[model samples]
Target chain A: MPRDGTATRTRILDAAEHLVIENGYAATSVDQVLSRSGSSKGAFFHHFSSKQQLARALVDRYVEGDLAQLEGSLEATAHLTDPAERAVAIVRHFEDLGDEIMAAQSNCLYVAVLTERQLVDDGTSDEIVRAVETWRVRIAEVLKEALAATGAHDVDADALADHLFVTFEGAYLLCRSTGDSRHMRTQLATFRRLLQSLLGPTT
Target chain B: MPRDGTATRTRILDAAEHLVIENGYAATSVDQVLSRSGSSKGAFFHHFSSKQQLARALVDRYVEGDLAQLEGSLEATAHLTDPAERAVAIVRHFEDLGDEIMAAQSNCLYVAVLTERQLVDDGTSDEIVRAVETWRVRIAEVLKEALAATGAHDVDADALADHLFVTFEGAYLLCRSTGDSRHMRTQLATFRRLLQSLLGPTT
Candidate 1:
């Protein structure tokens, strides 16, 4: 593809991502994506054969960007002297996501799609589940670092990470429903404290 | 109402409630309700004026029965001496719902509807929200009593109750997706301990 073709593809992908965020997967249509991107049908189809392919691309883009940024942040604090502090860093990384999600006027479309998911021949739900796996892996890495800090090494890191992933997703949806962040934050606070307690306090 | 008339009406309502719980309000069709209940068109219209009305009735039944059972469980724990213990009691109540949902093979439709709730008209969402409010009130009442039992009368009972309810709902949904209750249980464990800390140490 030429440079212009690549640019057109990126524009259509970005527009589809935003449309899915605003109108949701079921509600958003191909026409909306084309209109939002100012791209012709030929241009759109030249890049994505279908809307699901475009959505999968959005999920891939989001997961890659989110994980890259998350790894950069955790790289700073993973070696902290305090396990609790390391855990807190992980908590705050997700808390920052809460802020971003709220500012972005979304509650995590991955979760929204999951909640609305039904058994179907479509790959949308499959993409949603795959996205969650990526998040779980990200959480697991942070957790391994946190567990290694403060000399706490006995716990199952993968399981704890899985726990955090699900809770965070659930909290995102709950916070969206209530239109408040405290529920999400308090749970994070409580979970962080739990890790601290398990590590027998940093102070 | 005649005996058979009341029987048919109750059957239709029961089926509607089940369908709403299984498939959600938006996804459940009048024809589905009719097929599930073995009721005809005239019978469905005779009972509910619209699908929304059927959902309203399902909410009513859920609030009166399922929600009541949960609220009553929380209320019964009022005699516990510590807010921490009462928190455990509340968590246990929802833990039971994990089984309740599993046995029914139905998702916690409340959480499902809660996430996709914009699709539900305000009037219908209001009633579901009211049902949630009732649950919060019950938990808060128990918190008030339990806090009183421990002589810590000054804590913000309402806020704590709301926190507990939001966590309860979130945890239930998390448990559903993760298919394992260990994480949710531990998170609840941490919340329970946090309440214990707030109560101060016993002599």
Candidate 2:
């Protein structure tokens, strides 16, 4: 009887994500992933050709989930015609997501990659950059739309978008280092408040 | 004539800091530090008991310099009697610091330590937390003073202070990952703008 290759692959990825988040990519070894997942060396290799490949797979999967959440928020907010409301709603949506992540007590894979960029291969590194760029571009788009809708003339949508992203990354780091989950909530809320004030009252 | 042991220790630390910032603490070896600094294993062991000790020393040195800069900024802005102007000046001071960091093409050691927290010893880790707490408390003090002086009643000074720190950590991570120095300047500027808007015209 043949075993489920997909199940094995999922186990490896789950374990790898946890380890990478806990120990970072450089310190997380394939053997550790195998032992944690209870998968054999053969199963590990069957799923991932190399540690670098495993890293790539993990990043791709994370990117998929991340972008899905972003799209989900966009779809959920698509009904609102007001760009400002849509933008705020989208941020609130992520705030809710932050709540879920805090409840889960998981750190971000991207932060791990960002700090351990030189340890991973070029292709995997490029994916990290590409994924963050996608985020930057998407958030900037909505903000640009919101700024125009509000007739705001003094704000830079791009910079504000970067600020939002920066807050998420920074707050996550603080939360991880301090083990305070509310750090994320407070930081995101403050960003939202500042953003609202910058954009003025939603018209 | 005995060589200057202090000079040797400084060389090791300088090389270690660069490697840790570039490759992370776990991936960087004592041998690599020795090779980079042109110091022998005997010299390395003479200065530091272990890699963990080196990590602790690195963080201590970093924290000392970090707090010095913070104090230096506070001192330079001490002449501004108005709390609101003082707060704004403090933030502007950090924005200028961001510009300097970008120009130098360096990243934060605390961020590297945060991501590699598990690999470092408890004492080193505690120092990292303590250093950041000092920052949080100090900034919160100024922000609280500013808030009271501004007659603002709705703001949470502590949360706002955390926002500033979070922006620095997050913006630095993004800059490292993307190799875009402008990200820091733009993020810090936007933060300063939002903070000013929150504090209300700095009267």
Candidate 3:
């Protein structure tokens, strides 16, 4: 695509994401997307046929680009060779996602869609479920590596990873609601102590 | 009040709770609640003058009754006198609440109310926050006692309790969406290990 077309596409998606972030996927309209993006109906129809199609593309972009990039942050720090620092970095990774999470508001889009899965079909729901499972899985992998490096056989590394993801996601919701960053800090501190205890005086 | 009046009041509140749970608070209305409850307008006003009042009452009841009751389960096992078991019980309280949470299907009433606090300030949202804080305080107290009992003095027990509450509340939302109780087990296991680590040498 040419520069203009690429800009139009980016603009449309940015507007669509903002709208969904602001009003949820079900409530946002293509017309609103165009209005915000300054794209014409012809432009929208040319790029995407329907709102559902646009949503699919938006989700795809969100997954591969945004979520992937965030995961990459942890992956980048994974080879640090220090379990304690790795664990701390893992917590901080979640703490940093505050911006994307805030932009998306208090609930994850996948979560919101999951709650309303009955409106869709089992197949679509499963796809969304897989996306979410993948999220936790990635976090778990990082945690598993960190735990193994420290030889923390006492800690249920996989369980801790899953629990931390759920806990962090949940804490993010509370943090956003109460406008307090303290909850995230509290969770991180507890997570750190848990990791230390699991590893037992790591070198 | 007469028996009939009391019964009617109970029916009305139950219906309202269901409506609020089934539909978001703003999406639900007084007439809709009345229709759902099989009550007339006069009867609804007789019980509660307004929808805002009804939500406030629900928040109050939920905070005072339902959420406050969670500690009772932990208290029941307090005599175990073991930090490890007490820690497991604390996490189990949240795990057990998962079923009640799913049945309610409100998908985080606290989030919903907090999400729309500006629209309805009849003390509903504030009550929800208060309720959460109360849980944190209570948990912290139990944890303090547990810490002392188990001789774990290094960690800050109050912060740990607050983190657990926030994390559990957050996880419950996601678990309800996924309909997966397994994660609750993961959470419990993590909680146990963290306690063992903090308390050290459970045997």
- The candidate that wins on DockQ is 2
DockQ head-to-head 1 vs 3, winner: 3
Candidate 1 ranges with C-alpha deviation above 4 Å: A1-24, A32-44, A51-55, A69-73, A117-123, A127-159, A181-183, A193-199, B1-28, B141-160, B166-203
Q: Taking the true A–B contacts (Cα pairs closer than 8 Å), what share appears in each candidate?
A: 0.09, 0.74, 0.45
Q: What is the TM-score (0 to 1) of candidate 2?
A: 0.94
- Candidate 1 structure quality by residue, lDDT tens digits, A85-145: 7766776666555556566554555544444434223455454444446656776665676
State the lDDT of candidate 2 residue by residue for B87-201, as single tens digits: 8888888888777877764577877777764743365767767767888898888889888876666778888888877988888878876788778878888888877776776
fnat, candidate 2?
0.74
Evaluate model 1: give its lDDT: 0.61
lDDT, candidate 3, at B119? 28
lDDT of 3 by residue, A1-203 (tens): 88998889989998887766444555566888989999999999989987777776776676666457556767877686676667666666655654554555544445334333332343334444455567667767767766777666767656676666566656755664555656665566567666666655652
Model 3 DockQ class:
acceptable
Best by lDDT: 2
Ranking by DockQ: 2, 3, 1
Clash pairs detected, candidate 3: A170-B170
Off by over 4 Å in 2: A1-3, A149-152, B1-3
What RMSD does each model have against the real structure? Answer: 4.5, 2.3, 4.3
Q: After superposition, how far is residue A195 of candidate 3 from its true place, in Å?
A: 2.3
